[model samples]
Target: MKTILELSMKSVTLAVVLTAGAALAGCSEINGVMNDLQTMTTSNLPEQGIAQPTNKNAVSLKTDLVGLVGWFENSCGFDPVFYTEGTKENQVQKRFDTFQESFMAKQYKTDGSYTAYVKPDYRSKLPANYREAVKNISVVEDSTGVHYYVDFNNATYRGYDLSRLELFYQPESDYVYDTLYFKNANFVDLKSVFKTTRDDLDELRGGEFDAKSRSVMCYLGL
Candidate 1:
């Protein structure tokens, strides 16, 4: 009886030791993950990856639009809006507000006479179809008219602009892609798209008082 009691106590103590080791190992792994998350910052990223807003005080029309286009065209991987399907009015307003901010007029030239260039997706240097007219499209004599196109068919592929003017990123349905963003596009291959250089695309922003939008436009090849 004495020998059996001693053997059982030894087994119990071993079990307790094993449990303590596992708890320690788990705490160590969790501590390592916490450290990694703390190190991520904008300073480590490139200019395009940088999210410096032009104005910190107020959100205006042009900046909002340009910002929308910039994210769709330039900062694709960075924007959290890779997924959009619900047609809530608030969602539409959010997209409109974004497009209202990011595009600039220096890259987007407009005349008293305006024509709308629409593309559903950002394929390459050019769009599949460049339709110059749309009924009830906004054409301002002083303000250049903003054209709208829909990329309702294909919205899930890379190198595709994925921005429509009057619509969000819909899986299926008539969508409107805008020229506001496309008009200011500068094309480069996958390698050089985000490459850092003196003449990098980040220099495209301006405070000269120009129109900006969140629409994704095709490349004009600067």
Candidate 2:
């Protein structure tokens, strides 16, 4: 059960940075880049909370949670774009209700293993064409049936609002599942910083490593 998430761009540290006051216009939509990242990771937060006494009532609680998220943004200097974007909200709600309703309708034992929730649609906030481009992303498997994606634009569409809603039916997937990320991704920020550090590294290709025969390669001809 290997989950191979290929950015197809050779390297996948793509990011879209938006300067303040700049509205996203004429870009690749950079939609769902965040959701794409989340879907690739698994999350444990939902299992940790107080189970809503009644599933029907859970939506209200969940909606409040959403409001709380909004409030936190206003109260703190946090970015709303970071939280709101990305998720299949309606689908998740429908699924959650379905999961609860089925126990009685199907006359089956409650499968504790079953779970339901929505995942953000990373492309939700994007303009229509971009959203279509994102949805066109086909989920494929190799000859070995290991699923992977290919050929997405290497553009980092910033403005964190571009997002997705993820619903977890099973827990074994490779993607992380927290609202933000599996862990504090300092490495992500680090990659952005390192993006500027290229000095001739970019000019060199994989063949350069193949040609290197010694530890002195960098200084051999100097």
Candidate 3:
């Protein structure tokens, strides 16, 4: 699975950059940009974490999901810092490395691979009109751990409706293990879907920055 960074880098065009620049004018501060990124990614979602829980509460799950989605959409996806005007590449790389190390599970620190915890084609399955396609969310807790069930709208996998996502939350470590469940009992281990390496990030940074690429930086408020 290609990282969001890889996909966005390859697909960003000059026209898109220009349009985004005009649309995002006055979003100069990095914090504001981050907030905009989150809003852009999750604006269409319904209310989440409405169900009761025993171990981890609804608030914790909601916060974690929001943070995870925001990080995935912006920093992992477009990486505005990489395109920030006058910022050195090394500085951006260091920040990216630090963020990844802190956000990801400790296993990734030693294994040298970042687990996305979602299907490789999950984004592709989302309806074009929907920003965050999550239809509804319910949280529950049993003796094992806290569980979050996330339902999707108009999505299917292997001829079966892609109905639910089960997130097993570990309270001690504050990590989530996710699984995608289909209507027919078929499921995918989201943890096994994609693994990103530092080498991949390095290769992304090594790409040639052409005139259009520089224009993106300028348009993103430099």
Candidate 4:
């Protein structure tokens, strides 16, 4: 038979163990909740500039588009090489280099036209609520290619409203093998603008044209 003191000590020891286990469980649950909150906050951060998409295809597409938008915003439409779909060794960079050389030599004279055109107006048209605005992206795949459509939700320019911006990608060997298309304000096809700019530059410089440089010039209205 156990003494009263021994029984009392055993009861106290069991209570202590149970209390410690409860405390550990409570701490674990709290830590899990905190971790989940941190993940939610990080994913929705403003600087990230994108929300998680439900579409599986949009997962990779969202990352690519966000990067392109960020680059365009950063460059103010000057750096086209980043958005242009091609390798560095391709003719795009070479032509851009040539154009830069001519511009530096004053063969092409600019009256602050490109800067004035792109600086204020282009940025003004961008979505104010970037993260929320670009959250939903729709993907359509067909015989032509895979098309990812991004709706600006509330962004517009001039009298023209931007309903949908489409990015067409034809997958070939894990590389972007075609030009990117942007339908500006649901009215203007930016590809045509790029072509026209390229033609003008060719007429001015009388040299091989760069598609990448033309893209920048189109944004600048040069």
Candidate 5:
């Protein structure tokens, strides 16, 4: 009987020993994870296998617009040739009590008089069939009646034209994209867009200003 009792006690002791070992191992693994997280927090290290935003603030208006156009031209892949510097009249834009955001004047167009058609870039190029007329389009003009009409269909891909895109701002809220017909179109949010691009020329780009400041803390590891 004593022999049998001793054997039963031995089995219970072995089971307890195994349970305690598993608990210690689990605690150790959890501690290791916590330590790794702390290290990353202190060092601003990105988690393994995660991608980061590499876009820095552009130094000039051309640089900033080029990046913005680059993202908008093809769902954020290649440079789109369609954008020009925006004007006071027709360009899609956001306006706030103290701020606004919109495209600047095109590199080709200017405040002075137009002597002839500017050489077309990829963004402004359009097919003859798709050519826009002055009567049907909105454009910027000086007192002397010099104006250039935009062909909204200029940006195309794989024989498909991107639908007309425009932006408008309400001083009370965020900037929004809209069609010329006033239909609401969803596009990238500029508040977030500015955070990602971080353009230095954004201040002097000479458009409207916007008020809402987007948070890029997550991207900056703040």
Candidate 6:
């Protein structure tokens, strides 16, 4: 439950600033980054008038056990290479090791789902009561188990598509229902910004840059 401002101040502030200063001076992508910082942290504005009713479709318990397990194992694991370049391997590994300890799924529920808790080790980085206030993430699998229905526990900034908002999955089908309404994210703009910055860095460093990072979805045990 850490606030958006706090996360920016603690995690990406310096790095982003330095990158902007070094590569693209006075580019608008910096504004997009700032906009994302502000928008992604807070809850979406409430809907107008009466709230929409939950779907009446029956909840399905039939799950693809193997697919679900495989997804979870992959999602919760983190790789150091994604966090930094070759020179910072040890630093990335240390940080990722700590992240894995807390994020890795530990228990299989009797209800045929997987859950994970935020470990005490992350207490200092997270809100004081996050361990309790933030509930375990529940992963509900589809019939084929190729897809999943997962809860975000009201997370701040859930990646490019705002994937962590309150979402409903039809137990019998792959229908995903998102409660929040947001403008279509300009991923093209975001991607262009990243690529531009990356290209500049590569040119400056004689093409030594490596764009390798692990998928956050896979690291979350999927």
Worst 10 residues of 3 by lDDT: 213-222
Backbone clashes counted, model 4: 0
Output the TM-score of candidate 4: 0.27
Q: Of 3 and 6, which scores higher on lDDT?
A: 3
TM-score of every candidate relative to the true structure: 0.19, 0.18, 0.27, 0.27, 0.21, 0.26
Every candidate's CA RMSD:
20.8, 24.5, 22.7, 20.5, 21.9, 20.8
Q: Please estimate how well model 2 matches the true structure, expressed as its whole-model Cα lDDT.
A: 0.26
lDDT of 3 at 122: 38
Comparing candidate 5 with candidate 6, which one achieves the higher TM-score? Answer: 6
| CA deviation > 4 Å runs, candidate 5 | 1-68, 71-114, 118-140, 144-146, 154-185, 188-190, 195-222
Question: Pairing residues by index, what is the TM-score of model 5?
Answer: 0.21
**What range of 10 consecutive residues in model 6 has the weakest lDDT sum?**
59-68
Residues 1-222 of candidate 5: C-alpha lDDT, one tens digit per residue: 001111245764565566566786666765675577456444543233222223221111101122122233222211122233463211221121111121223343475533323243322332222233111333343443333333342232222223333332222234333222101222223323322222233321111212232111111010
Clashes of each: 35, 36, 0, 0, 13, 11
Cα lDDT tens digits for candidate 4, 1-222: 111111245764565566566776666765675577557545543234333334322231122233223222223233445346684423434433332222121122365311101122222333333333342455566766555555554333222233444444444423221122233424333323222212334432111223432322112323
Which of 1 and 6 is ahead in lDDT?
6
Task: Predict model 3's lDDT versus the native.
Answer: 0.38
Candidate 4 whole-model C-alpha lDDT, 0 to 1: 0.35
Candidate 6 stretches greater than 4 Å from native: 1-97, 106-136, 144-161, 165-184, 193-222
Ranking by TM-score: 4, 3, 6, 5, 1, 2
Model 6 RMSD in angstroms: 20.8
Give candidate 2's error at residue 154 in angstroms: 7.5
